[model samples]
Target: MDLTMSCSSLSLLFFISLHIHFLVPGSGKFLPFRECAPFVCGDKNISYPFRHNERPTHCGYPGYELGCDGHNPTLVMESLTYRVIHMNTNMQILEVARKDLSDDLCHGAHVNTTLNSSLFNYTSSDLNSILFYDCDSSPIFGSYPFSCPTSGDSYFAPVVDLEHLPQELCNFSVLVPISQSDEAPDRPPPSEDSDFGAPINHAARISEILNKGFEITWIANTAQCENCTESGGICGYDWKRQRFNCFCTDGAYSPTCNGTRVPGSFPSRNKKMGLKVGIGMAALGAGIVVTLILMRALIKQRSVHFDGEMKIEGLVSSRRYTYKDIKRMTNSFEEKLGQGGYGCVYKGKLGDSQLVAVKILKKLKGDAEEFFNEVASISRTSHVNVVSLLGFCFEGSKRALVYEFMPNGSLEKFIFNRSNTLEVDRQLSWDTLYQISLGIAHGLEYLHRGCNTRILHFDIKPHNILLDANYCPKISDFGLAKICSRQESIVSMLGARGTPGYIAPELFMRNIGGVSHKSDVYSYGMMVLEMVGRRKNIEVAVDRTSETYFPHWVHRRLELRQELGLHGITNEEDEAIAKKMIVIGLWCIQIDPRARPCMTQVVEMLKGSVDTLQFPPKPLLSSPSRSLAACPCESSSLQEGNDSSWGYSISIIRDRLSL
Candidate 1:
């Protein structure tokens, strides 16, 4: 025990001496920077030269400590706390503003802005001036003035150089930094009749000008990082010592790790000590990553679902739960929420009390293509409108996907009464329906353009639209989703996907146009039109047994400026919202895929005023029978009943035109 204590004490003494000497005895280096941890404070990410208190001593520059006050990140300099607006690592510049300052002059004004000269330098781009508060008399006309509670005594010096200012006219003053353009201007002196006691109309003017925040450039430059980079070491700041710290592959060090000779050129005096340091460094990420990978591989090997497959991709962003946990949380799959073509969703509670919908895939083989596609496609997205994939269970044949449990069920239940019951009890307001349309538009935009990879949700209908607690629409069910490179403009397809009513005209027949993002637009337009008309767009007529497409009927009403016959469209505002949706929806379901607007344009049109929207051409897709009869060539092989996927397809007109 004494020997053990002696060795430990000697190790501590060696560490202290190494820190003091700035070297590791004869090793001629410090230690690796594995201790540093980069993290996000509020919305800002902190790293080298700027760190939170939880970071290590070698993490950031001295005097650049940051702390979070609740959710907002703050930086204290010279006894004043400033809210960090943003920090750019490449520019080495930081934007911060006084936390106490307000954008409203009706409130109060008090600012003490100061920057340590050694650590920060006000770049030439930044504007500066002395702001004096409450002087006996206001300064000359050029000095920006504000009407405070007393009078127009509050004013700021205009010129950047402080010496030119008339010192005799000022009272309490502090040097403040502001943006170059649009500096504060003096408020007009109130006349005798003017109410001095009453706060001015533009009370927020002064605060607004000053609230833009100031930028500060760090003293460190490229030269400091140059030498370190050449020696295969990363240059960083040591906050405690107030100096540069170079983090190297083998170990961290001061000065430069380029010193001495090549690592293999010189023989180490003590190999045993070097081996111990090497082992410590390996455990950080490099060696640890492999160990983790091996353990996961072994776990996957024993799983019934993944036994045949070595690995799967695109599901790394979400968690993987065990079958026992899934069963316990779901109460043995008792509370079934809904069932679809792929699986059944059961309501479950996570350990953290978060309600989740666990979708258990039925009869799927270990390497089912649909299972991978669903998991891989949904996992790549993180948008409010897009359904979030919380976790999954792939224990052999029991494949289940976990998602945030939506309180309200699928939108189909509310929008159209699936049950043939004539119970018109609670109808969703026009406002709620309009908002849902916009939300669905934004979701499609995110999938097609916002994410890293382009995701095309082939199936986009009212049945697949799930509503949450607030009736906000979440686009769910990625059974027919396709992931492609953003660079790839068009995607190839094997067979037709999606419900017949909502499928794009082009997807039915490629001749109309190559399959692109507009396909989803066509689907969204069809679904939204049904929401506006309050009936299935493609209902089978009882008398003639012919299909009644909604976009055509809605377009006719819009063209003639007739009443839409919407259930909740009581007032002008509700009528306008309904009319706006019908117009945009018609534009989306244009027979020629090219005639339809993209999802982005769809969102814009929905947001735009009803007066601005223009009626689209009569939907030719609604009456394909007329076009076929008009065809001069009777032998043209445009068979109607050949394809069951598209019973009322636009391909008839598309193929007819090709003739």
Candidate 2:
């Protein structure tokens, strides 16, 4: 039986080799090249390396495929579609324009053009042009003002004049690539004599430049393709093998068509030695396939068992404690620390006499998936500025979280005058306040960028920031936090999060932008403003006759070049620190989320000198009349006077107040 099985296998291998060498046409010689011929889309000629979707997969290089939308050819790269304008195969360059921006400039969503760096690179002949949208004020110097009939105010400027343009005044700006010709001098600046004709001429000029498109040199295996074509063979790619192949009448060869057979291609053989070699090769391939299958099964089985054990251990790790243990650690709830919407907090001590703060969570109706997930996320964080989670207790409805104790408690007590008299008597110095702000910014920066999983502390205010013995600030209270992958730019929320006074405008109004890490920056800005003002941002006057928005008042004072008049400014250094904090806070609270700096930028700004800081534009929500409590409920009333900014502010205020 063993001899018969061996004979059967050898006979099968010989039959396959005979079939390949005789039966299938070009099977051992070449691939069908008729389907890979050059084609035409619109007026452009599409050839080798760039194939239409109708062509076979082997006809084009990977990621260089195109699709036809009616008569025009479109290429989708990195999610943005572009209309092909011209292709220079000799120079390996392509000229294309953004399909969305080709017909109407302001019709699409605000997004900058981006290219895949590995596949294409911008040519030096292309210059960057900035398009500023929803600008509150016209540029004072080097920008050409324009208006979109449907989208209101906008501005345009060349890259050379970026410093002169009022970018801070704009809600958002997009960087677009445009062709720069030597004859035109790169969109000549508007003349001093004709203000009216300048805008019209500039708008037309911008349209022409964008339509002309920009050039990008494509990165491909051009040298290999050229060698293959020079050898009188058709150049193509092997989709299955994921490499270049040259197709000749005799066979398909790699690198070049030099009458060489690729692996697996069988030729005619007449000797016993050749038959034995073919049989051995076939048996070896079969053995390798079988070995791979067995190894894959073993690895998968071990992985499942290991993952199951890890999960079981992770569920009942050292960090988890029983409800009975919590009672003994907290001394039967004897010493109360604080209480909030989540639950009450109590001072506790471990068996080693180490201090801790235990937060007893309220009873939730559903399973504890979200609870355990949040605990796991917090456990992974090890930053000094972030409060550490020591242990947790989740037995039935009784749940609690243990954290490392902060001797100084929350920051609100010291910042708010009415909270603690002792804390007010020993007021924090300006330097201390600045350090706290910088520390909090560092904490946020770590959460946003340094961690494996990005943690968005939706609630970022004075009340959520805790100070240690050395007065170092640590971000606390993850009740409303959202954990997402670091690659995620925007997170989806069912509804608005964060406190009313410190919430970002985009949380309640979708028109502002998506909810992202920028939202946390806004909250941080509001808190810093409160720390500088030493009062609530929106407060009624002592006489109760008028309401004042502190941010607006601070902006007016700065614009007038008057003293900030803040307390604890005994020297020029103190004055400079206060001014720097004010300027940074203003920048963080811009109406459009895109205008706000990231937490990393905020950290850099805090470390830099006051002279390096630029004064931010007037925040749209800074008006006293637009206070969350004062805004009218009717949408029509909010939209009156063609004031879109006011409308957005009113909408945000209404939603936040209702929440």
Candidate 3:
């Protein structure tokens, strides 16, 4: 009887445990633990939908977690992004905060950690997916020296406009020092000596500053310097190099930070898992193998699989042949035109005169829906600046798009590629660039005004803007694009979209009245600046001594009447053309989106005299998160997979251009 009672009790306990684990409310059991809600790990204070510990563990995933160190707060997951105070929730959009490292006081004591793809990953368990390395500091215009009279602490703060700051720093975290009583135990000591000697009375100062409500970057020690430089890794310190560690570069790894390995050799648990999975999958495979065997035996009784429903109109016409035909057209896919956002574009000829650019999309699964959407969206619009789609093919699982061949190829070749140095020097003159700029402007205007629904060309860099034989610019790659009607007004974006540098600020804000045609105008302005400077916006301008965004650098040079020199005055015509372009570019990139002229207005400004245009204030290097608001273009170092060669070349080009 005792033994039977024990067994019954054990059974009851087991059942109760299962019920508690699986049935209890808010117990984080079978609830959506695999996909974390956006609010689960963000700032819990400040208000609305932004939440902490509101989601089940399953919903939050491995990377998403609300971290607390007793006093202050932090949110960490795959990518290390910080939020100010989380207050708003109904919109479900969290604000991303960046620290301004240019504050010498903060720079002296703290370090900046670059949480790149190699170091960590961004798991979009939350509604928003952020690219974390996009933080930037203001350029050192002229440094002002300061010494805390009480502690003999001195450093330099790069002189950026404080009046226009709050507008410039909408979505960022400024670290203000606090008094000893308010400081958190987890906070790192300001000095490298392992102890912050005295408590700072920063609350009063912080309150005073906050009362002003100007967005400013406060320096602090949230970064992990010791962890970063522990091994033989290259240390990426703060702007002042006070603290930081060396993590391994590409094709390298080790906690000790020594040695390098081929990409294939990188340690992965997936290999072991794959072996285990193969054994378990063997049983299921046998049934499939037998089925396949039976199907093969009855091959003679089977019908052809090619002729199915062709739901997409232009996807596969009767004239559309098979993959075999595409093979023969390109002579077994022999020549490659170039690679692009969708996939590799191959040069092919249907007949004697009809040359076509065949775009073979990369290996993307379940993209049929997206491909069909793109075709539908692009098919409705027609303009000289927009790439024309001849037709597309979707036979079986393979998909390919055909377009009219631009014999001169993409603008990237002329603007970014060095191989066409001679051709560009002779043919891509200032007049040619101006024409290209106009064509691109017209294309943007058409999307904004001409179309029944305004289309947002999310990606507007030179690479996406192709140049034809006459040097006319054609906007390509409608992927990552959105369409909105004027009546609808606002289109809520999920997280951050578009390329790193060219994305707009309001897009980062939750339901912040997005979908303004002004976003595209801002991107165009950056592109125009690129065309004028003949360099990417992320790269530093040549004339500037330190690293700064090209547009901001131009603003400063213009302020000093030094802007013209940035374009190396070869003659009166070149100087005149460059000056006009710079001033127009500056006006197009005004910090206030409302202040920025519409694309139609931009076209007028470019065509109008430089003297008529009011010179824009110098571009401020605010927090990276705030860049979308003021600068729009993200700096070069902030981009992922940014090759050293790419960064070096841009730096060199800007230097040469500055001459």
Candidate 4:
């Protein structure tokens, strides 16, 4: 039977060779299999990169080689190379074939292998070494000394941790060759009876198949090791973990192990010394970051900073200004433009004809940084529709801002005054009103989206809008503005941010959603309708003051066509402008934040056809109990005629108490 088996094996080998040769005619090109030599033979179909002749000198990195297992074509790389798993322009990853256990007897064969460090190179600077295994099932497979820092144990189960394994064992799975068996001269035929168990095949039997020191070539620019340098690291084999160990030296830290600091005076020169330094550096950096965060929190807690002059390094410089200079400039508060929550505003001349308005900022229950930030943020932005910052003064317990004078005064003066009602004669033409609308949209657009960071004008109302000599609108009073990331929508309020009547419904109900740039769009829309109507919808109609707010009132009228004066206003031009403004306003104040058009779209509408305008569904009007709050509008500035005739003196608009 032995003689017959040997003869059969020789004949079978011949038959396979003949069949393979017909497909690949060259024999001289075959590479011999030595300890580390490349194997190349079989079909021409497998050539260069995957060759049948001698493996090309540069076919792959040193470890990978093309070979034929007698009659079976194979690609070998170290201990694995199960199959080509992936190949892209940059690199390739292969599945490692598993090694099968043939014998149940432990210690059946002494298989010992060691990697010669000089034979192959490792391509990944991030990766250290390869991990191997020693299984009790296969006695022929010997224990290989790996290069990791930690000793490893038997890991021959089906699912292996790939990340923990070295590059060579990456995707490979091992199985015993079926061709090798103990019966019939140890050469098994392909038939099921002779080919079946792993008992016939063993990794140790095919010594010719084993490779040593496979060199992994540099991936060129393919893999980026942004932080690694070759010098001062111990690049030696670590049998414990079966991977290369790179111990960094010389008071350094980081993945590249390149960051260096001065070493302490005691030079123990011990390898363990670097570990102590690494811990100290990490602790120090953490402490610094923590301290900064705590400092900011403390500042906010101490709200009295707003009452005194704050000397911050980067924010502002401390200085003094005589109150006399302010009195002279304002002519002792003679030309009072308006009065509000902040303080009274007076039109003054700084230099010859350099008209400026001075506003004394209100004292607030907050950190000085909040007040300063408001001034700094607005001062930096320069837009045609935004009020320009003129120099300011910060005296002890007193802070005042100076801005370029808007000669035509506030939008409320021209639009809603019961006495100085020239608005009918100085009617806002459709074109001029449209231009003003575009100007206001442009300013809000800048605040919402154009800056490096988004700013929300929490107090957007007609009084805060000032008209210049040209009737172009400029937004003012940024004291209540919120500075934040555009992505941040809702803000945790110490109190409500906007006025009662104009505030969006979402602002009051925190459960509804967060407030974003869209919230400001809603306020600006309410202001637009106020400007067009030139009437304070809430308090104007004596009886309705207890019923509807401006925005809701506008919606109700439009729904009934009483909005546009459907037949038309007695004054055609004013009526048309009113209709257009009302439509644009509806588009702005949509209750669903997403439904409202952005400021950019608002500007486009003002310039486009009013007929193209789309009106949003009417928001339910808030009842008087929920909407009206003591008519926040204060008593009007008393004129000379009223004072003389009524025997009443002009009660000065008291600072905080008036608004």
lDDT of 4 by residue, 424-462 (tens): 656666657667878999999888778777888877887
Ranking by TM-score: 1, 3, 2, 4
- Model 3's TM-score against the true structure: 0.49
Off by over 4 Å in 3: 1-322, 365-370, 418-427, 509-515, 540-548, 566-573, 621-659
Angstrom error at residue 256, model 2 = 40
Q: What are the per-residue Cα lDDT tens digits for candidate 1 across 310-374?
A: 43544578898889999999999899998877778899999999999999888663356566777
Assess every candidate by TM-score.
0.49, 0.48, 0.49, 0.46
Per-residue CA lDDT of model 2 for 1-659, tens digit only, reads 46446545654554454324322343333333455667888887776688888777778887788988767788888688888888888888888888876777766447777776546876645656667777786643345566777665776654323323456788778767776542332323335313535444246655666777878888876778778778877777876456787766555667677757656544443335455456556765655554465357554555444433343255443388889999999999989999987778999999999999998888542344335545766776878999988898866466788998998999987787563233456588899999999999999999988988888988899999999999999998776777789888876542356787788866644434568888999999999999888777865334311236777789879878998898779999889888999988987887767667888888888998788766776676432222222111111111111112332233232222111
Candidate 2 residue spans exceeding 4 A from truth: 1-318, 363-370, 417-423, 540-547, 622-659
Stretches of candidate 4 exceeding 4 Å from the true structure: 1-328, 331-334, 368-370, 418-427, 487-494, 540-553, 566-574, 621-659
lDDT of each: 0.65, 0.70, 0.48, 0.48
Error of 4 at 137 (Å): 84
lDDT of 2: 0.70
User: Model 4, poorest ten-residue lDDT window?
Assistant: 650-659
